[model samples]
Target: MVKGVILRQFHSLILLLFMLDTFANSTDIQPLRQLRPRLVHLYNWAQRTPDYNVIWDLCCDHGLLGLHLHQATTAYGTHVHLVDQVEPIVDKLQTQYAHRQDGNLSICLTPAEHIRLAKQAKQLFIIAGVGGETVASIIQSILPAIQALPPSPHQQIDMLISPNKHVFSLRRALQAMPFTLIEEEFVSDKGRHHEHMFLRYQPAAPTPPSEVGDALWLPATQDKRIYIDKLIKHYGALSQYSPTAFNQQALAAYQALKHKLFGE
Candidate 1:
């Protein structure tokens, strides 16, 4: 009885300390209402996707998006897995979710490439808030597993990726792969342009992914226009710096895109 009482008191003390810390740093901590626009857009897009049995939020920092997904998808009996390589982050997440009885949520301390993909279950893997190179590397590591899955009428594995940089190279690398683009969007948040893409895996893909993205130029939104300008400038600088055939080609591609869009 005495040991039980002491354990209860320790738990109460830990809770009180957590509450105090939260209260002290409340200004620095962004509430759910203040989630970044890019994340909000990603979540909204994920919500539009078709039925899925599981979601893997890879490189999930702070677990905001995954937690939000869990809350929303729990009703549909979806399992949400948040994976991060950081031990501290995984520990904190485990603590936060220890009380849940639903057994549908999992927190894994592993690299995105290390997690096993569910072959039979419809799954959506969300890789966001990381550079395109990292995202590409993770995809490369997991491509073999994705390819081994049995084909189904509903795609066995779908992906939603939002990478902050090197999107062109990432797309170029994916062009020869089995991933087919289903949706694309450009979001400007905190003075950075993010490319969000939804893709499905097929053993025999019908359409090759565009290296520079086909539909990004169609809408001509202010953000898209600005991002196009940045892309042109970026490629121009790269071409000057290296003058490689590939760099020149990339530079010319963006310049041509600009002319096509603005009639320059």
Candidate 2:
């Protein structure tokens, strides 16, 4: 009886080890429990648009979002590049994920603006977890290099950006560029409001004010109202402090937006 019990225990231990190994090797890992909603929103958006040959996650801190994208689209030949300027973070990510069997991942220790792309590749650049001003600056810095590429019908590049603040300024900057807004969303996460947008460069097309996206006011939710109020206060302060024609115009626009959204 003793021998039989030991034998059964040994079998159970082996089974437990097998289950652990399977779990560790599984590709369908659940998202990190603490992932912010803005990142989650971006990941879902990437999954929805899976035709890109390469996905670049700029300023990718821990490479969580890029890794998630790799798992979701690797079977379809999508490669994920995680770019960050920090050396330690990049090295850590490289050590962790660079040895995967499928080999569709790259970790780049460089600024977002320095990363270049092949002219014939369909690329999606995800810029998140930063301020709007920084996001705009990165876009501006990279625009010249991207424009110099030889035009190809297959060379499609898209940017998905979620800026933490100064969204209106960012919107204006984007409008001034050759890019057109494809989609925009206002996401409230962890008591913070985030504005996310997908933009594609279309040099021949003009971007209208509608493309700048007033969608933040459409939902009529408390969060939306709060966001509007914040915008109003922000522009109000800007107009009061600077009192420039530009500031006044922006204030007028925000006031108009408030009136349209809340009838106040």
Candidate 3:
């Protein structure tokens, strides 16, 4: 038992050393290169947004996206807030970045619904790598708080969203909100399809988010075509099995969208 304990301790020490070394090496590497293709796409989309004072990266697991954004936007005086519900994730991120005295980086231990931003600052929120339903819930919870904030000509709030599943539900949720679609992309990465949307909140805008997006279908790249077919199949199956009103509607919508796009 004593020998086993010593061996375990030795293994733990080796792991600690390896992790430290890896982290030290990673610091010198380009942060963007370390991200997955999906995140890299998000980073690119984020770069296109007009100057914003603060960015909130919700559900920031491992803080990679937030860290990269902080590095890229620090010169612009943009503050990056990384939020997660997990205690260990937040604690580790705080410790990892504690050496930096810059006020631009913040690690918060909280749920996405509770995120607070500067009322005066134009903010961007990126919520990715989660299901559409959860993202909808988070957005719904925060809308009231966000609506209370004073508006500015330069204070438009933007959300960069990439939902992993049930994307139609997310779009439906957005359609009920004050947000209008700014841009949307259909991305296929590592055999997974993602719909990335850039939306801005406009209280007076007449148009709401579309249940099925417009731009993503018009171009109809091969990936988009494939994705639409997949979505039709999914919704079609759901409609047949469940036959719920929404599922039937979604199936019809996608079918109509496909026919409109490819005349199929």
How high is the CA lDDT of each candidate model? 0.80, 0.81, 0.85
Q: Give the per-residue lDDT digits (tens) of candidate 2, residues 116-179.
A: 7767888899999888888989889888878888989899888899988877678778778888
Q: Give the C-alpha miss distance for residue 101 in model 1, angstroms.
A: 7.6
State TM-scores per candidate.
0.82, 0.83, 0.84
Candidate 1 residue pairs in clash (backbone atoms < 3 Å):
none
Instruction: Measure candidate 3: CA RMSD.
Output: 7.0
- Flag regions of model 2 displaced more than 4 Å: 1-35, 208-212, 238-247
- Segments of candidate 3 deviating more than 4 angstroms: 1-33
With a 3 Å backbone cut-off (N, CA, C), the pairs that clash in candidate 2 are none
lDDT of 3 at 174: 88
lDDT (Cα, tens digit) per residue for candidate 1, span 71-143: 7887788889999899998899887666542688888999766778775788889999888878889888888
lDDT (tens digit, per residue) of candidate 3 on 29-111: 42443888889999998898637799999989878888888888877988889998989989988877665427988888988
Candidate 2 versus truth, CA RMSD in Å, comes to 3.3
User: What is the TM-score (0 to 1) of candidate 1?
Assistant: 0.82
Clashes of each: 0, 0, 0
